[model samples]
Target: MATYNPIRDMERFADALLEGSTRGPRRMPMDLYRDGDNYLLTADMPGMDPGSVDIDIDGQLLTIRAERTLPKAENVKWITRERTPGSFLRQLNLGQGIDTERITANYDNGVLSVTIPVSERAKPRKVQVSTGAPAGVDSSEVVVSEA
Candidate 1:
């Protein structure tokens, strides 16, 4: 016989409501930062199957989706099942200056890392300044003044 606890039942109900099993995709925590010429994004997805991870980029939007499915067993009783299994999703708007075609992703040890490279045209570069000398004068005689 199973004992009925209202508090436990309430907790289960709340967990189901917040887990987003049927409401939609659950939000996952992620960290994004710029490293040198590339932007790095790492997301935490422990216990998630690597094959279930999906990443897509559309225009300026970058979306990440993954699923965590529980195993099935016959005649098994779960004790204090707390881990929520469902779809996880996250989207980020990557403005201009990003090399969308060069973007790469990798999943390792339950962490998904994405590398977004900065476009060549958006990189910082120094411009050369030249001083024009008169046609009649020697180019070496020209003096350049710094303001």
Candidate 2:
């Protein structure tokens, strides 16, 4: 059985009510997945010109902005104007361990791909501790290793 959450439902209702008045820039759909020591982020931005997209990294904040302009022809009559032509905005806070300086991006077939590498300092490394006198404890103390 599904439980009803009033606060969540109310928030959705409020969003629907304000979506029309908010200038209607739809959020880009994003997929984030970790591949080994790097993260792959993909955003589906169909019909967007590759040159119009901008990626900015400020501190740990990653922002993506793109725009699609509607053709302006005086002779054209549109039967349906459902496709909204406006800016696409998406922002993400990259947590610690991300190598922001070496971040790379590519656009192909209306999809934006960003590769974020993990910093070497944040990668896991094995520390070898030989059996000997415990650093500060007794000289004949048991040596403990973390798993």
Best prediction by lDDT: 1
Colliding pairs, model 2? none
lDDT of 1 by residue, 84-136 (tens): 67899999999999999999999999999999999999999999776776458
Checking candidate 1 for backbone clashes, the offending pairs are none
TM-score of each: 0.76, 0.76
RMSD of 2: 9.6
Instruction: Give the clash total for candidate 1.
Output: 0
Candidate 2 global CA lDDT score: 0.86
Q: Score candidate 2 by TM-score against the native.
A: 0.76
Point out where model 2 deviates above 4 Å.
1-24, 134-147
